[model samples]
Target: MFSDILCVILFCTLHFIASSSELQPGMPNVCADQEMSMLGARQPCVQAFTRMVKVWKQGCNSHRWCMGYERRTAYYTVYRQVYNMDTHTVYKCCPGWRQDGKEMGCLHRVCSANTCFNGGQCAETGDKICQCPLGFKGTQCQYDVNECERDEGGCEGFCCNTIGSFYCKCPEGSRLGPDGRVCHDVNECEELNGGCQQTCVDTPGSHHCECNEGFRMHSDGRTCIAVNSCSVLNGGCEHKCVDTGNNNYKCECRKNYQLKRDGRHCEYTRVHCSCRPGFTLAADGKNCEGIEMEIVNSCEKINGGCSHHCEHTTNGPLCSCNHGYQLALDRKTYSDECVSGGACCRHFCRNYPGGYECSCRAGHRLNPDGCGCDDVDECLAETSGCEHDCVNTLGTYECFCELGFRLDQDQHSCIYLLFRKVPQLLQYTAALHSRYVSDEDDSDGGDREVEIQRGRRGELRLSSSIVCLDGSFGDDCSVSCEDCDHGVCSENRDQCECAAGWTGIICNKTCSQGTYGPACNSLCRCQNGGSCDPVTGKCVCPPGVQGLLCEDGCPRGHFGMHCRRKCNCPNNGHCHRLYGGCLCSPGLYGRLCHLCEYQ
Candidate 1:
């Protein structure tokens, strides 16, 4: 009986160990640190599952405990369930899945119930699609679309299509066919063992070109250079050419200088020169000087002899005869005295200092002084140039024009109308003395027609008696008294006078208070005393008088004129009165003997 108890105990113990080998209550299969799976506890359940290990019980209640026989039986049954759980679906206590002694299910089992579009398996996902093992797209199962068909060339140069990928077209310097669709550069320089003979240059398209010492450029394009110093090489010649840039050169000189047609020699100025008029040679290679005109002894000769007027000609002298005056029959000199009718005009005549003038008749005037003739205005009968409506001025007329008319070039008579309408010629008008005539055309016969004498322009002839009191001459007689440097011609007597301290018509006004005569041409003697005349200005004193105003003569013992003499007195003695000898008073001695006795 003991042996039987021993065998039963051993069996019970073995069953407990077996069940424990799998996931018993509160136990883990693989380490609790293992990654989770949809197969749940068949693999293992971690701590978050409170029933990580399943405990055997008499009934399927959380609080129920197993009986002695029931615990043993339950242990044995749970041990078998744990051992076959992964491959077997039939179970007793664990209704669904059994992992060791604990029962659970595959988390993916419920997901297999749904379908997806296009045969895609419908699997639970977070927010995005979760594909099944060999499925794609829809809930139940899927499509096997080729990804590469969607990507056309994918990029530029050449298309590179990979399994599910595509890459851009790449030419020579690139590499490809990697996990990502991209191309990387392959340095040909490194492959060719360090590139160019002279220098390595990188470029697009292709590389490997060459440049000489003075030039440099990229491999992919053409490159060239030149010496660039041709001008310096030819000694900067006038004109010539060599080669420079890209193979070209030139030689030339500065502007303004010419280059020989030969294209090498240079030249400055192009002109060949001579001299200018009146010029002489200069020391400098190019300049000259002017020569003066010469004057000679022979005078310019003229055709006529002396008459009323004479003018010097280039070769000699020419003579012009006035109206009334003429050259003698010999034609040597001018003469005014003539017979009843000479070369001169009629009634008016006179001989001048050098020539002669002709006087016109009572009702006329000589046009240009002694030149010709014109009528005088007598109508107004002497009331200041005329008295009433003037008749025609004769030969020396008052420039009288008839009613509504004026004199033409021949001032002798009058015309019924104006010679010309322009006023420009009016500038020649002078004094413009005028009068009225009868305007027969208009109703007014004698009171309306005006006549005028347009005398020489800028000239004024005052009455002979009206002279400039301040000593002025000429037409306006405008001369200043105080600064008149030419002295003056007295208005009262036409006398010549010098302003106060000066002399000469223009006064030549200067200071000469102590001098007198023509122009202070004489000295004064105020040292003695004597004033000068206010006009002719001479001193009024006797021959022997001398003083500031000539008030006194020489004192008692002095004589000779101007008090410039003295008596011959000895030793400073007193002289006798009125031509007497020295008095020699007291003990004084000498000629005038006025010395004191030796005391």
Candidate 2:
């Protein structure tokens, strides 16, 4: 029953649509060929044809009356043609009008009423009606189908409805596709990256902007800017912080400080203290003090806990013996039972506080090895009793006079010999003769020669000769001498005298050790194991040492020749004294001026 009802409802809806289509004035004819032929014959057609004609006439009457007098006359002319067709008169219809059958009923030709709207076509049926095109509805297609209400008009973005038509639209950053109903990404970035400051990316129906590494987008979402890593907390550095590229930073410390394990804080590298022995660190950890004081004080509080007196020293506490008591082998104990036999002392042994002292007799002194005694040399000491020469003995000294002199009542004084004046005169005469010989030798040798002699009265006498031979001197040409090394020979004197600094008669000896200069009278002052040049009096210093006396060491950045030569070392390097080449620092090589090995 329900199926029948549903079928009836469907058939009724279809019938309504068909009836509505026929209501238009341009509908096509619905009559069959037999009915059309019977209408054209002299006898009338079936009743159904008459009913259909009556309906057409009623529609025409109503349209004519409503359209005014002019349309009514035109309708009447068509009605008369139809009525006259019953009389079998052979007549023609007006232009754009035609007969439905061969002899009677009249109707409009195809689309004769011009009643269709929006490009709809008009056709002839029993009555004229409009045939609407796609996207249109109603008798004249005056209304538009609302495509937007049905699935968004097949548009990817927006839709708009219009009379007899509809169109699709797109939002910003989007465009309509070739289908004319769907939207696609506009690709605004295709032209100059969408005018973005860095990067641009396309999305569904829109476009967005981005930035590259080490940069961030601005508030406008299009511009980019570099990141500043040091702006916050100075990159967590305690002393100094430097910003590198790509938002990175490094930390550094001040002089005398080093970076801590955290890589942010600084720590002191040097502390203030005197590095003394028997000392320990103080509470502050930066100073030092003697620990012996504390130990001594503690020991003193316990009275040293020794069998003798306690003494405080820098080394702590010590046990001492009392008078008449000897320190035992244990050293910490004193014993009065031990008596001295004087065997340990070479002289008089006297007992003193804590130990025994040795005393020497007159003219003798005690040695540092307390058990021995040494003689005091009065001759070398300033307190000698003698005024002149003093001779040292085992335990005493004696005064004496030199040769040709005698001691007075005061044994320290001296007296000259009785014939001293005669000898003095002889010595003076000999000196005068030597001068005369030297003067004569300076003159060019002529045909004469001179000889010198001493008379009985201690006076000098000279003799001359007419001829003199080579290597011989004197008036008789009798004196002779051999050639002298490092010396000049005096032709007149026939003698060789050594030059300065040459002591031997033949000038064969050089200056002795520890002496230099003209006459070998100057003493060497060279120090620090330096050697003095015999001729120049200059000192030659050893390696790593320089200066006149070799007293100064080679300072940094300098070496050789009194430390006057500058070093060519680079990168905090040192140099060798013998060779001026550079010694590079750790991890560096190749003349010290090149790049590091790692680099």
Candidate 3:
């Protein structure tokens, strides 16, 4: 019953939503419930997701894992016909961008975020181009230009510098000139009484407010209040108060060095500290003092730097090959063992990850030693679901029906096909069977089986021609293609699709000289003058490109190992894709292109 429900894509394959097809309607829903796919979802399993940087306990970079923090699961009421089964597809954050958690969108990249300062906007081209607003300059528009720095800002009064522009200010008794730079004298008493509560006094360039003898001027300088002693509000002190002249006082801490929060409270200055990546603190409570070296398991860091499997041991992560394959000396790669020695077995071999397993022909069983092929007597074992006689062969078995019946498509059960049987016809068919049947062509001349043809009147007739089963071909279908020893039989059933490094008529020969791939027909695709494995065509890129294919250039603003390092070049400088080096801009000589030539 659980099969009817589409898997939520529990922990992976969220990219399936991006690539689904219409599932054919009323096709009997032939897919098994297990086939519903956490591996392939019909739609977006996650409604929203976020990207995270520095994910803990994480160490792989492939298109197989969804690089996101999923916030919630999304359900669809309508069923979809399409499903994406490509195991390699997954949503991932582009270089220089990470998810907030593992949610829906790494939608934010370098330019997508607010990287610019002081009203600067980054270009969407992903080259880290920062477009600065007026009165600001620098790579990220971080520098505020001060307009008043030169020629006194061409103002008669004082000039005030602001973010984008500057303004002029006149003296207290003067009004700003129409030009906004000149100043004109004016009487302060004429306007708002100079902001005085009681009396106003006008000066040459400013004004003053006065209060009665019983009252004192407030901090605002425009209002007055009654004078009070330290008894009022405890002089707003949190520690010992020292009375000064005119009821004024200062607060002092006892054990601590300073006062906090408006000089009213006292506390010790707390130090919040932390250590770097590989170091821990000492037992003596020193600041990051203990320095110890630890060789972490490479597998834990990056799967032991192996392309296949990595096993952690007492010493370190040891790379190992998958079954049917052998590890190389470097321990990071593996080679197919079947082509080397596995093909010696009489039975065929099936391919799988890491290794291949030897499999016997349709009705044959492999001997204990694995090289010998023995026929399985389905008649003796009673395992064949045949409704009639079961005939055993050298490496397979065949099912036969009673005189009036015919073989079913299953090839095991008998179906009533003949409308009537004649005694003379039966005798003639019996004679023919006795003359031609002995085994899979072991009788006299490869004529072991007879062909059944349907006539225009819907009656079955025995023909002299012979047709082979699915895997068998040749004259009577009795001749199984024994040539494809450890490889797959080709579509035409004439040749074999040899493994990466193997070739030849029977796939018994290795790839010749510098050739690789199926039948040794393709060449390696290594770039930057790199080398490659002749058998697998696996490229070994030089110190430039970061892709396994040795493609030039890296993701935007990223370079170096795993393309994980970000470039800090300024003024549209190019960055090395594999080394994280910045190619400085013209006239800019320093590492980050910050130093000017004249300087």
Candidate 4:
């Protein structure tokens, strides 16, 4: 039944109202009730509806005609007699004029009521009563019987009452039952009188400890102890033992006395000489003097009182290294010169505290800027090596193979080494140089014609120099057309044409998209400009545009579709080109200013 109703509503809204082509002068009503007709005498129906309205309007005036009742269920009937001509026409026209084609349909909803529990309903028989579930009982179901009450065999300990519930508390030293009922003894003596130190006395709900006489209450007020100790002055000093109460104390010697090894005797003795570690026995046996006693100061050593490497001023040993010598690992002086193998690289060599260091070879820099050697990239023009790739290995440079050739290990120059003909020894080197040289080739134009042509399978050459030396043909007398510089390569002369976002002989530097200027430096500068090709960094201009580099912004009120037409919105809607329309601004409607109504 519910499905059928929904289908009817859907059909009315979707087909009848949506499609103007589906309208007809008269059609049979699709309502479930048969009594109601599409066209009926409207007078009697209106009268009945008016009376129904009066009964439902609780606080509304009857004359106002304002609808207050929920039109949940609809009743339709064809009047046999014509009650009023005006009403008849109204009834006939009403169905056709419905905005959604679903007029006069009815629905039913749950009714409102006062009886609720915890914000929920007390339905059916108990209309206005709060219906609480089990374990709950009260006038308003707001309170529960305190099972924990003192009388109802309740909480044997303490009682706590809450809304719709109550809890039990065990006696002072007992625990409440699992069911929250009776209280059980804790047996304070079991856990050592709750950690107490004496006999435990269990009371109704609590317990107390009985400590022996001499013991005072501890912080916990439970433990006991012995009566006397060394803590008490003269309390237990049998042989002059310092009175230490609570079983702890120390024995001290009387005044003018020294404690013996056993901590019992006190005796007075004269001076004795047991010299310290750093000092030695003096010949007199009454005084101690330091060993190795030299009689010179630092100033005296400065004035050359000592020999070659001695500091005789302060009477201490000297501190100096022999000529061309430095301290060895043993801190002993030795004259030594570092040979080529041990000499430091370009950096200066100084006599260090011990040993020596060798600087690295030339064309090399230090690691961490100054600590270790890192071969310099001689290829960098600034560093002044070869004009090309500048690969810096341990100590030397091997001229790299140009774009096409591979470098010869023995000759120190580039050589024509093919993957199929030459050994794999040069493969790694060829790959590196290719990557490095290709980046610079674009700026060096001359080779543009070689890109377009097809060559023998895998027979592509890297440079025209290779071709010149090998005597190959393909016009322009250049080398392999495989990798050309100018944009894309022209098959003829090793030539290439640059693409967008790329420049120089070969497509090297990447140009930013949505930007176009010299060297692709300046952006389009046009606000709301469409993004050009990402690679070439060009701007797609709309029609009727006039400006150098397309940098001028769009004119006011005229936008979209080549900036051809003026914007059209009711009042002032934000014009959106993508949608080909304007979004009416707040308090506006219709295209451009066509409609003048507030939102």
lDDT of all predictions, in order shown? 0.42, 0.55, 0.56, 0.43
lDDT of 3: 0.56
lDDT of 3 by residue, 1-599 (tens): 46445454532455664433322222222221222333434553324444435433344465444444434434445444455553333334444444454345443445545678787888666545588888998767888889899976888888999978899998666879889998988766554455455568888777788876545765445444435434444544556766653334557787635775445457776555666435567665556764556656657777776657988764456777666567655556664445344344565754445555666787677767665565666765898777976654444556766565655545687766433222121111111123122233223322211111001111121234444344544322322345364478877774467777777555667666446777788876665444567577887654344567767656445577666554545422457775668765457777765688987
Segments in model 1 whose C-alpha atoms lie over 4 Å from true places:
1-21, 24-29, 33-169, 173-220, 223-238, 242-256, 259-268, 271-599
Q: Return whichever of 2 and 4 wins on TM-score.
A: 4
Worst 10 residues of 1 by lDDT: 450-459
Predictions ranked by lDDT, top down? 3, 2, 4, 1
Expressed as tens digits, the lDDT of each residue in 1-599 for candidate 2 is 99999999999998886655332323333232211122332433322211111122334554743322222211111111122222222234444445553423346554545667878787545454677788887756677788789888888788898876789888976778889977777776765455355568987667778876646664345545445545544554668988754344567899989986655567889856654437787888778777544233625566564555887666556777666666655556554321334335565665444556667888778877776666776765756666656655446666766555545444577656454122211111112231123332223332122222111111232222334444443222322344355666655555555555654434456777666655456677776445666555687764455688876655445656776554545422346555556655556777554568888
Cα deviation of 216, candidate 2, in Å? 2.5
Model 3, runs deviating above 4 Å: 1-333, 342-344, 348-357, 408-410, 415-463, 466-599
Superposition-based RMSD of candidate 4 using all C-alpha atoms, in angstroms: 41.2
lDDT of 1 by residue, 1-599 (tens): 99999999999999986764443333322222233223333334223212233455565456567533222221111211123223322222222123433333221222333434444444455532435443133333344434445554444346655533345666776656463455566554443212232344555544554655544442212222223434333423435545533233344556667754434456685655445434566767577766664533222333344534666544435566767556555444544453223435444454433444566665555666464554443433453242212322222223343244433333344435332222121122223232222233233321222121101111112122224443333222323343234465555533446655566445544545667655566676543334465335566543345444665555434554554344544322234334536656446666535356885
Cα deviation at 284, candidate 2, in Å, is 44
Model 3 steric clash total: 22
Off by more than 4 A, model 2 = 1-114, 126-128, 229-599
Q: What TM-score do all the candidates reach, one by one?
A: 0.18, 0.21, 0.18, 0.23
Can you give the lDDT of residue 536 in candidate 3?
Answer: 72
**Model 2, C-alpha of 353: deviation from truth (Å):** 98
User: What TM-score does prediction 2 earn?
Assistant: 0.21
**How does candidate 4 fare on TM-score?**
0.23
Q: Which candidate leads the pack in lDDT? A: 3
